[model samples]
Target: MIVNLSKVISELESGSRPKGGVKDGVGSIASLGAEHLESNGGFNFKKVKYVPDEFFRSQSKGIIRSNDILIVKDGATTAKVSFVDDNFPFKEASINEHLFRIKVNTELAIPKFVFWYLFSNYGKDQVLSDFRGATVGGISRAFVDKTQIPLYSLNEQKRMVKLLDRADAFRQKRKQAIDLLDEYLKSVFLEMFGNISFNPHGFNIGKIADLVSEVKYGTSAPAIEKGKYPYLRMNNITYSGEMDISNLKYIDLAEKDEGKYLAREGDLLFNRTNSKELVGKTAVYNFTIPMAIAGYLIRVRTNEKALPEYISGYLNSLHGKQTLMAMCKSIIGMANINAKELQSIKILMPPVNLQEEYSKKIKKVHNLKQKMLNQSEELDNQFQALMQKLFS
Candidate 1:
């Protein structure tokens, strides 16, 4: 049955509207933000926050108990969903101003079942439709209340959750395999190239300009939600030198930008503007699809002397990032290591043949990694399909 969230949820409350009233540095309370919501479920303690326990104890902020569904209500990450299940660690946690708490009435709905629904495509579409604002959008309490949820019998809901949980487990294992292969590649790079910091191989060193044909900035095109061309943003490149394509955005390229900021396969992307901590992130354009990059990024086209993988890996390496960060200029609020400075940075140049050999070896592992990625993509599509069918 299709029913408003107000029907299924006993209460819907927004967290503190303007957060940060609570003092930090207090270990007793763990403050929860939209970032805590992980893909699988629950909180990610890897990047958690601590607030004063007094606030949580006094019930000043919205304290989330087990089985509460958390939804983000503001900014770019608006509409993100998380289920705070009993297994979530921490004796107490409170939501910040940007989140909302939805307590399901156990008599009417199952928390995990409802969580999987809200995490589905249908749920996100509904949330996005309700969002209001010109710049940074927001979800109001009334809008969320008016949001509809598809419900089923309790037994049917339980069975659906059980099946979805099993599917998620398989995806988790696939992710683990990919992580292990990545680790193996790291080891191989270390064994062949040695530490970039130590330079034990005595390779000849020269400015990066000698190894690249062009270092050009990307397009400053206005982006759209739906477009003909896939686009890369600063956030698409991870600090570890891998592309996170799961959340890629698209923009219709203008006539002038069609070929101006186009990224070809084997091109290396460098984030030229960001916070000091995340600036200088680099990733290879390994995907075959034609895509455009944002102005905040720089594209480096390497000469025959250097492979794109080699250059990308080198820049992503601990030493490579440190070198870039050291040379960047922080002005206004963004950091930049423009084309000129990037070309001047000293780089270790080993024999191109050695880099080719390493690339060939890594290709075998990448093939398997690609297979896993395909399988995971298929699984996600199937999961969403089933979810939509059940809910619709």
Candidate 2:
């Protein structure tokens, strides 16, 4: 048998309206945002924002409870979903206007089972069909209530939930393992170079311009949906200087533009303009495929004095991060450090041979890291495939 969405569940709620704005400050209640929802099964509390305590106290509803389902009701991330696990500790938290807090009727259906179903293609297709917004898409409670869902007996739902939970746990384990390897790389760096922040070993400090041969900004070329060269943007690089090509965009850069804008191996890409917290995030381009950097990124080609690998590692280190943050200048709302300013930043330059040796060691560790990352990606892909199959 099948039922409409509202028929199968208990509650549908949009969270507290912001009194003034959602800006962070000392607040009585912790508030949830769309950012807190993970593509995976958990919340990243570090990303959780806040709501005024008085506002939360006045609300008759919208208080988040454990076991309630959550969805991003508006914005480009519309249709994303999560189920509040019993293990979730924060019971006082409420959602922002951009989310819908759902409480499934537990007696009729398992919330966990329904949560996974929403992430499936069937659920997404329904959501896409009901999408209502001109600028940023949003879903109304009325739209969600009208959609139909497949029904299963309680025992079957429990069984399916168990299987999916196991798969999810396995995928999470793989991710955690990769994170450990990344930490190990940082540990090794500190052991060899001893935190570049204070130059604990008393190495000679040199200007960034003295170590790098050339520094250039990427083109402002307009990008098409599909193109020849992969376009590297700020979001493609992680804070730790690793390249995440998952959401890479492409551009049809002209032939003449390629020679100027195309980035090669060993090039360090710096995020020159972004939120202050994300400003100066760096990534080393190691992919052999031809790729072009976007206008917001500055490409730094290191010379013999500073090995590309060593400098990338150094710049992403804690000391490097502190130094970069200090050098940042806010323009409009975006944080930026121009090429000339970037070139003037101080760096601890070890002997060329020593830096090269450290680079070799870093390469070996990265080789291991890539292997684990590959496995993690494969596991996620397989699990995703299974999820699609169940609701195909």
Candidate 3:
């Protein structure tokens, strides 16, 4: 189980190698430098940004080439590493000085296997452990060359890659399904609610504040690990409106705080603070949890007349989203939506029955969405497991 990576493969030791880091500019590799690097890409560069030499001197920039395995040196994204495939635009790429590219001996070690190891949890931990800095962390080149990595035979690596490829394919399909469902829901909403300009016969324009009973902000309670109560931070919710329980945090709260923050079934959680694209994102709880909402979110409880499904769908609609965006005030780093602003936004009023009808359509769409997302998650898990089996 304990394998010495150096013994099994050759190490592309760093020193006198080109060094570079992320920059806020775009240019070609030859003109930029011998080293080419990208800050973030999905293992391919259908769209990617290149680092500028002005930020890093010509001598300090690290050398990169096609088929190189990039290692993010520092930052919260340290664990993310990708192999430079043929599709990359640059003949050579440079990395953020915080990142280092691993040029593995292809004959001794499989590039895909090396990429998988760098992406694994264990590898992430290893990279984090080597990080040296106070405010901004960074991994040194010497650290990477000395770090141990496992190696597998070419045939075994190929087999593992095949399995992983299949899993990735499945994940892609799931993502497509989710996207399709989203489009379907949008079409259904327009069909039922009409364009924002008008509504179905007899429907009237309604102020959102009047329709909802109470709009309250979440708690700013102290958080603790493994506490009695869970802390639902805004990050716990995804842009796609799914609950990510894996990274859940907890807090210890007294009875008063518990009563205030405890999320019950039918409650709607809205992300009030985030990027402009995600500021107005919303999710409804169809489940129960003893948790306190963080300051970054708001909890809205609808009156008996208003339905959770109807509100959730409406909030996700184009008109609703536009209204929320209009209310948003953006600061340097984040955009914020307040309760007052949210309430003042306008929504079209349909009859209670019509609202219920829209709710049912959303439910059906949500079912298909959930299935697709579950499949995507399953595929992602399987791919991760395959990486471990192949490299470790």
Candidate 4:
């Protein structure tokens, strides 16, 4: 049977916080935002924010419960969904204005079944098809209410969920392996260089400007679906210091502007403007072909004093993140770390040969990671196919 999503849903409302917003670790009640919603249909509390106990008690709506589905309501990651499972760590939690809390009517449909359906490609397309706004996109409750859902028997829904759960677990294992490798690299870096923040090795300290031959910002050119060259945006650089060109747009630059805006091999790309948690993301450009970068990113060419890999690794480390968080200035909702500010931050300068050795080790790890990523993609494709067959 086909029906509007509103039929199966008992409650649908977005959350709200007190004016001036919540603070990190300020209160006992966990306050989830869009960032807490993971792409894998789960929550990520790696950086948890909180709401005051008194304020949480005052609100009647937005109170989180097990088996509830959450979706990002606005901004760049609009329509992202996550399910609050029984294993959720927080006993009392509420979401901020950026997320919508969904309660399913158990008698009509299963919560996880609805979550899986909304998380599917077909459902995502439906949700985003009516996406409104220019600078910050969002969807209203009307859109969610009108979305079509495929209804199935409780037994059939359970059967499909069982199959999907197994496939998702397999895919998650591969992702966990990749995460472990990243942790391994962090350990290796600590073992070799110690913590740069403490200057444990007594290495010479130098500002970023001293170690870089050039620091230049990217172009403000408009990107299209297809153009002469691939366009690199702030999102291209992952929080873990890796380049993700998979979701790339393209741009065409004038002859004179090409040399100014394009990123060459071995250059370090820095995301200068983003949310407080994501600002200062750094990655080394290893691709042979040059790509034009957007205005929000800055390209740095390392001098003989430092390697791009070493700098990127340092910036992606725990200490590096702390440093960035301290120095960055928040403007409106976004944080900014311009070229001048980035160039002034000091770094521990290790020996040239040591930096080269770290680079070589990282290369090997990246090769292995790429292979695993390929396998993960294949698994994900299969999972999506299964969903299409079942939900279509």
Clashes of each: 0, 0, 20, 0
> Worst ten-residue run, lDDT, model 3?
32-41
- Local distance difference test values of all predictions, in order: 0.80, 0.83, 0.67, 0.91
Pairs clashing within candidate 1: none
1-392, model 3: which lDDT tens digit per residue? Answer: 44544443454423232245333455444222112233222454433455454432464445666766766666666546666668766665555444565676777767766665666666666656667877877666555545567655778767776776576666667776778887788778778777556665546777667678777788887688788877888888776565666687888778876767777777888899998867988887666656678888888888766776666677787877777778899999799998887777777777778778887777777777777777777776776676666556
Expressed as tens digits, the lDDT of each residue in 318-338 for candidate 1 is: 677688778888888788878
Runs of candidate 3 exceeding 4 Å displacement: 1-66, 86-98, 105-110, 121-129, 132-138, 151-160, 197-203, 226-228, 252-259, 318-323, 365-381
Top model by TM-score, which number? Answer: 2
Q: Clash number for model 4?
A: 0
Sorted by lDDT (best first), the order is: 4, 2, 1, 3
Model 2 TM: 0.92
TM-score ranking from best candidate downward: 2, 4, 1, 3
Model 4 per-residue lDDT at 171: 88
Off by over 4 Å in 1: 17-28, 39-46, 52-59, 86-89, 150-153, 200-210, 219-265, 286-294, 303-305, 319-333, 344-347
Tell me the TM-score of each prediction against the true structure.
Answer: 0.80, 0.92, 0.74, 0.89
**lDDT (C-alpha) at residue 366 in model 2:** 82
Model 4 TM-score, all chains together: 0.89
Can you write out model 4's per-residue Cα lDDT over 218-321, one digit (the tens) per residue?
A: 99879987799999999899989999998999999999999889999999999999999899999999999989999999999999999999888888888889
Q: After superposition, how far is residue 283 of candidate 1 from its true place, in Å?
A: 2.6
Q: Best lDDT goes to which candidate?
A: 4
Instruction: Give the per-residue lDDT of model 2 (tens digit) for 1-392.
Output: 77877887888888776767677675767788788887775777875667777878888778899888888888888888877887786868898888888888988888888888887657766766778879887888885666677778999888888988999898899888877877877777787777655678888888889889989899898778989999999999997778899998889887877878999988988899998878998877898887999999999999888887777777787788888888899988899989998898877888888887888887888888889888988988888788777655
